[model samples]
Target chain A: MKDHAGARLIKDMIFKCAVCLFAFISLLPLYLILYYITKNGIMVINWDFLFSLPRPIGESGGGVFNAIIGTVMLIILSCIMSIPCGIAAGIYLSENKKGKLSNTIRLCVIVLQGTPSIVIGIIAYLWVVAPLKTFSALSGGIALSIMMLPVIIKTTEETLKLIPYHLKEASLALGVPYHRTILKVILPSGISGILTGILLSVARITGETAPLLFTAFGNQFMNMNILKPIDSLPYRIFYYAMSPYPEWHSFAWGASFILVVLTLALNLFARGISVKWKIQF
Target chain B: MTDRTMLKERFVKWVLITFALSSLLFLFLIFVFILAEGLPLFLKVGLKKIIFGFKWAPTKGYFGIFPMIVSSFLVTFGALVIGAPLGLSCAIYLSEYSGKKTKMFLKPALELLAGIPSVVYGFLGVIYIVPLVRNYLGGSGFSLISTSLILGVMILPTIISISFDAITTVPKTYREASAAMGATKWQTIYKVILPSAKSGILASFILGMGRAIGETMAVIMIAGNALKIPTSILDPLRTLTGNIALELAYATGDHRLGLFSTGIVLMVIIMALNYLANFGIKRKPAK
Candidate 1:
């Protein structure tokens, strides 16, 4: 009995140690990648790097200004396109409670969410670029809007559902119309959550390259035309990192750092809003 | 009741309903487009050739997906082997052992893991993991093993959070009863608590499998983009996502359609696993 108990204790100790070791190993890559990007990648991140446009192969003077501009454009366009549609869909799903139509819509959202971004890129290519005979910000924005839609809708629906039913009931008991109750009470309550979803979508769409690859068809310089080819941070990072030019490789790392920071900032901001909003409640 | 108020309420409901219908319609259009574009390739080439053909050269008019499919499965399996246990254990530790402070810190940290972009993970795989694998495992530059390790880490957050929710849901009454019967703490956990959470854990595993199978960017960056079936852990292999990402840019006609078919295959696998999770949820024993 002593022997068996001793063996079991040893086995338990071994298992705990193994788990700890595995957790450390899992974290190693994120550490290494972040370290490299900050170490070598930070050197190139200067005012010039941020302000100037991307130069041709082997040129070291220019920056990722065009890509940054283009990313903002894409995010704005995507948000504008997705917000109302996503919020309304989310509201409908949450309020309907249960039905065949609602279940089908829910499943459709899930399936759309599961579809790969690359496939979305391809279809967007066929839909927008092929017919228009141009690769543009509008195309990239629409592709990203599709990607953003399910995320926002799912999050918004969840947030609205989280709002207590009693609140809506109270407003209705006050003789308020349903629309006034929703607009004045429910939507105000859910605004932070809706914003959280939109911020996440913006952050996600900013870093995406595959969808933009087929839609934006990456350019080197800034162009304001929504109908013209545009540069984005992810595409620039992809193009520069793989190119034979040494200077371009450095630029790729810098672009990556900027992109990461932008995403992290958006994420942190959304988290802060959610936390503050929760505390208020 | 006021007529204007009734009209406004009806308008709001109708507008919301229309929005929902439009979203559903748009999703249906995507499916239709995928089927319209992808189904024809299978018809033209026959399912056998695409499924069984060994070669994947588009220029040569040959489009075999066997190797890519096999590699995707292998990587996902390897990742599960590495990730699932650690994740489950982490969940167990968090739920059963940790104090409030630790739980508070760890929960958010775990969630942050899932929020990190796939591209960043891919970058890590290339610069850090690939080299580490090359050094320890003696690979050329990159390998299936490296990709699996990175993906395993990436999926850890999903598994841990879900499993944690599951394990936490196991009632205190069971634990109290087992303790009253003179069962050791460890015994109660292993024999009673875990068994009760079996369905939830299984569902978590299925979700992890879905994430692993659908993953693209990280695997593409480290999987070496080779088409051959790997004989060893260190052997380079290419996945369906890797193939599409690398070659989709220049592909035309039949080749492009082949890529879409690969997407279909990926979706089918994921949907099947999702269904498995749904089944597990439905099969859970009533309290």
Candidate 2:
């Protein structure tokens, strides 16, 4: 009995060690990526790299200002297009949960979420630009909005659903109408979750390269027209990295580093906010 | 006197319903657009030629997708093989061995992994992993194996988090019952905890598969972009996503249509996998 008990204890120890080892192994690649990106990519960061316009071949000094501006512009435009639609749709779905219309909407949302970003780009190309005969930031922004909608709708609907039905009932019993109750009471309660969804959509759009390739294309010089071609950070990174110029490659690294920082900050911030809301499981 | 208010409320509901229906319309339009653009390409270029032909020189009219399909499968499988086991073991460990303090630290770290962009992973794989593989393996300098390894690492967090949640949800009573039987700890975990957690493990595995299959930038960066059937892990290969990314810029006419068809094929494969997974989960929700 003593020998059998000792064998059992030894086996338990081995199992625990194996588990720890697996956790460490899972983390190894992320560490390597972070370590290399900081080391190789940090050297190229400076004011000129951040502030000047992209340059042509053989020119040494240029910044990715155009790309940065375009990315922000596209993101803002996408928000304008998607936020109202996504939120309203989400609210309708939650309010009318059992209806056939809501069921159809729910299925659509799931399929959209799974559709690849590249395919979205292609569809945008066919519908938005094929008629207009011009590729513009507006087209790119619309494609991104479609991509962002499903994420926002899914999260916001779930969050709104979490607001106790009693709150709605109480407001209604006090002579408030359903729409007013939703607008004033439930939405406020669910705002944090809504913001989390928005932040997640923003993070998702920040890295997207495929959709913009055919829609927004890329511009080397800074331009502000929504109806015209615009440079974005992802396109700039793709172009500069693939170019033959060393300076272009360096600029790409700097842009990538910036992109990484922005995504990381937003992601971490969203996580922190969700925790602060202190929602119960 | 209250007629105006009733009218306004009715208007608001109508507006809401219109917006909701439009969201569904969005999905319809996009899928319709894909089928419209892609179906013509299949008719023009026989399915057999597109599927079986080896050469993909579109300019020369030798377009084939077998190499890309093979590469995608191989890379996805490689990632699964490397990532799934580690993730499952970590899930097992988290559920069976770790203290609360350890789990609190570990879960967030895992989440952080999910947040990192594929672009950064691509840059990392290119700079660090490709060279390591090249130096160690001593064949084609950049190869499918390195890309697969990077994908494996990138997806580990997804597998671990989902499976961990699944395993932890297995009732403690199950573990206690096994322990009370005087079974060894390893034996209890293997026989009792894992079996009970099978559905969660299966779900996580499917999610991981979805991620691996759809991944673009990281695999493109390290897969060497060679269009060939790789006989060895050290050979270069191209995947469907990478091929689209590379060719979408200059492609025109039927070439453009062919690319969309490739996208359709990818979507079909992904949907099939998702269907299979959802079916499995529905059949055995208890797991």
Q: What are the lDDT scores of the predictions, listed in order?
A: 0.81, 0.81
lDDT of 1 by residue, B71-144 (tens): 99999998999889778878877887778997887776676667667776776566667778888779775787
Off by over 4 Å in 2: A1-6, A243-247, A279-281, B283-287
Q: List the residue pairs that clash in candidate 1.
A: none
Worst 10-residue lDDT window for candidate 1 chain B reads B278-287
Instruction: Name the candidate that leads on DockQ.
Output: 2
Candidate 2 structure quality by residue, lDDT tens digits, A207-278: 888778778988878989998889998788777765667677777788888887787788778778878985
Steric overlap count per candidate: 0, 0
- What ranges in model 1 sit over 4 Å off? A1-6, A27-33, A244-246, A279-281, B1-7, B282-286
**CAPRI band for model 1:** acceptable
Model 1 Cα lDDT, one tens digit per residue, A1-281: 88987876776677666656655565554566667878878999999999998776555589999999988888888889888899999999989879999999998888777667877776787678768878888999989999999989998999999999899999999988889888999999999999988888887787877678768878987899999988888888877765667688678788888887788788778888888887224
Chain B TM per candidate, please? 0.95, 0.94
